[model samples]
Target: MVMEFPLLEGLSPVERREFIAACTPRRFRRRDIVCHEGDPGDCVHLITGGRLVVRVTTPLGHTATLTILGPGDMFGEQALLSPDARRTATIVAVTDATTLTLNRSQLERLRLQHPQVERFLTTSLAAQVRRLSASVLEALYLPVETRVLRRLAHLARVYADGAGTPALINLTQEDLASMAGTTRATANKVLRELEDQGVVRLSRGAVTVLDPAWLATRAR
Candidate 1:
């Protein structure tokens, strides 16, 4: 269940321990909504055990998946740095899991009290900036299939062990379509194409990359 946990390797042991101490641990069941779009940004979540899907709904009722986050990944930290911030996306638990929750005030205090925490936030935010910039470019310039494939490669990379052992990305066609800004039928067709070419193996909600190199090519 702790698979694909993001590494907070830069944080020192004492800082990590203190950060955890300042948070409240809570468990969530599969598909539970952790935070809704437009909600007051009250708490930052440190995913200790679980996956989260970040999504946004457009005016036409179409939803787009912004990203998927796993254990050791934190969210809502921007709220701690901004006084008038609201949640920009809805976060839902993709599995039954536990997370440490820190309210805005607590997180702000922690940032002030620990330079290591600040460093962690800075690194995380820098990564986010790069990711968001790439996302914007993908949304504007990439084809739907290319965009979906890019996300698949991202999930594969995230779920894989550093040694390159592949793992299934547990998500449905509809979910993939949402992430790619397309219809489920289109996403299913794309998946079938990849599967036919031995690029990926699909079963129910799980997709395993059979040829990551091929998938990576399509991702670009």
Candidate 2:
């Protein structure tokens, strides 16, 4: 079956077909490490199902989650630009997941055949850079509560299933804390406050965003 990707939006039918044909599908169980930081980057993955987290570790052994990604998101694109590029962050499966991967060689060949492919990759990389920059700025200036709210809002937006249902973030408080660069205790406190305000409903291992718009406003 042919899978559609947002990154391939501008490609012609033939180009899309060729790109899909070149891709190899891979699956991972929950908690599986897709790639580790500092490892040789070999392929770019476009998530086809479930969710994953992008995390980084400091030299001092501290680890933090940079972001959560779901279907339609792509990762490991840096490899396509440089042969010696290494993974900048670790990617781990948040749930049982599947992805369509394109190796460096296949992507290089496709870029020569279709200039738009290169443009797509460049655009994706730029977006990633902008996101990282924003995260740095937030960490430097925002208070812990605001940072937590912003991170929760981001997850809600990414994982929202259309059909008018509320967005449910299937993650533990510890995971949310890591993503927000806070302690689990602090995250739990903020979540309880949000729950009292009717912004979210917290259950074991999950948070249901009841008022995403309100939460986003508070995040700002």
Candidate 3:
């Protein structure tokens, strides 16, 4: 299936066209493994449709999702910049997906041909550094409930449709727990509490915030 490559929102028109032309399209079924941790980096993926779950495996072999990324999000970018770098996380399709892929060789060529691409990548890496730092801070200082709330706030801000409506996206409690650095049981209990209070709505794997302002307060 041919899908439009999502252009990075702020890039110049010429840069966008060049980036799209260099990308190869690929499709994945639900639960398909995109890449495994510690494997030599081959390419970065840009989701055109559906979702991808990013996870990291602990030393004990437990895997926890770090995020559920959909269209407009890019992955495996670290490997493109590093020299024969191994992937630090595994990416799997959470739903059937189509993605635009760029191999390392193509990325390197783009970096030289398009200086703007290098600048864009550097900005993304900086943002990742900030996000990782915030996650570490949350793990050190926040309670489980607050951490979960904060994560919900992020999802609601980025993916939710409107007030008193469920997020248009799907995210399981297991995925939430992993992102919030809490147990699934804990995540479930908190979600139930939120539902009981009418602060949010939960059905199946969908979570909708009834009052985003209140949810933000809870997150703090």
Q: Pick the candidate with the highest TM-score.
A: 2
TM-score of 2: 0.87
Reference-based TM-score of each model: 0.80, 0.87, 0.83
Tell me how far the alpha carbon of residue 61 in candidate 3 is from the true structure, in angstroms, after superposition: 2.1
Candidate 1 lDDT (Cα, whole model)? 0.78
lDDT of 3: 0.80
**Worst 10-residue stretch by lDDT in candidate 2?**
1-10
lDDT of 2 at 94: 85
Best-first order by TM-score: 2, 3, 1
lDDT of each: 0.78, 0.87, 0.80
Which pairs of residues have clashing backbones in candidate 1?
A: none
- Per-residue CA lDDT of model 3 for 107-220, tens digit only, reads 778878887787657666787798789888999998888999998887776565435555654788888988999899999999999989998888898787777888887777
TM-score of 1: 0.80
Residues 152-201 of candidate 1 have per-residue lDDT tens digits of 88777656645766667888888888778778899999999988988888
Clashing pairs in 2: none
Q: Higher-TM-score candidate among 1 and 3?
A: 3
Identify the superior model by TM-score, candidate 2 or candidate 3. Answer: 2
| Position 160, candidate 3: lDDT | 50
Model 2, total clashes:
0
